[model samples]
Target: MLMDAFVDILRTIIWPLAIVWVSYIFRNELRGLLNRLSLFKYKDLEAKFEKELLEVEKEAKEAEKLLDRSLPHIADNEQEKIEQLLRIAGISPRAAIMEAWREVECALNDVAKQEGIRVKGLVGNSLSADKLAQIRGIPRENTDIYTRLKYLRNQAAHVPDYVIEEREARRYVQLAIHLAGVFRLKPNE
Candidate 1:
């Protein structure tokens, strides 16, 4: 009775699974046969799949660009905090603004180091020249954060008239947030 039951169980489960396996092994042939029966055209179906795949790729690229544009906004809170500190220190409005630019530059250089990015003509407190090949995956960018930061540091010793654009500020904020991820930071906490 036990052997009979085992065989019955095999008949119900194993046989079906074996048939499924065989069908799957010949799935392409079966699909071609079905297509030839005028049920559907494989070429049209394949083209539809390909078109959908291309659309998906296009959407992914757009999303990546949007994310890139959004990244620079991550440093806003930090900029606010730093500005408040400068204000509390009794610095002039212009001086406080320049200090904010310095923070951004510092953040960018620091982030580059964290990501192992190599930058050229890296004057002042910027990412060093030895970091390029390791992080070629990172895009080459020229943000005001880098230029203004270096400029501010240069002019900081003399006149405090360094100016940073609003766009640069936003970009640096995004960079700070991106770098934070590499270092395993949990946002502003």
Candidate 2:
């Protein structure tokens, strides 16, 4: 008797959820049916669903744009890349700093390669800033900047609540440019 009661309770809960899921999946069909029968009664429901759908699409597009803009522009000639990062900084300092740090990491990696420094990471992968600094044998001051950049990048990437100031972002962009110059890598036009 207990087993039967439990089964009946499960069925009661499951059927509604299953119906709602199917209705959601076949919303188009439901809309058409509603249109054909008792049209006035369901008009409000249809309008509400359509409004929610439009909002979801708008949010998806904005998310796509943000992701595209946040990627580091390493291939852009150095000046252009810095400009792009600065522009992003104007809107989102965290994205700007993270992008600038990526450029710095790429510059450091290139220098390591040109100098024949063996990074500890696997082949074809860039080394972490600290590991790259060790391989390059940079001075203590340089090491400090590299470590700081690494910290900022980590926070920006992993912490949703992390914030960066515009001034700090600009400083990081300049530092990345300076470091690239030190490596003698010309930013391509």
Top candidate (lDDT): 2
Model 1 bad stretches (over 4 Å): 1-69, 72-79, 82-91, 116-139, 143-145, 160-189
TM-score of each: 0.31, 0.45
Q: Residue 59, candidate 2: how far off, in angstroms?
A: 42
- In model 2, pairs of residues that clash are none
Each model's lDDT comes to 0.43, 0.56
Worst 10 residues of 2 by lDDT: 180-189
Local error of candidate 2 at 181, Å? 3.1
Candidate 2 is scored at a TM of: 0.45
Model 2: residues >4 Å from true position, as ranges?
A: 1-76, 118-138, 183-189
* 1-189 per-residue lDDT for model 2 (tens digits): 999999999999998999999999999999988755653443453344334334433543443343212323445576687788889888887777667766666666676676677655422223344455444443334444455445546655664534456665676566655544433332221
- Backbone Cα, N, C clashes tallied per candidate: 6, 0
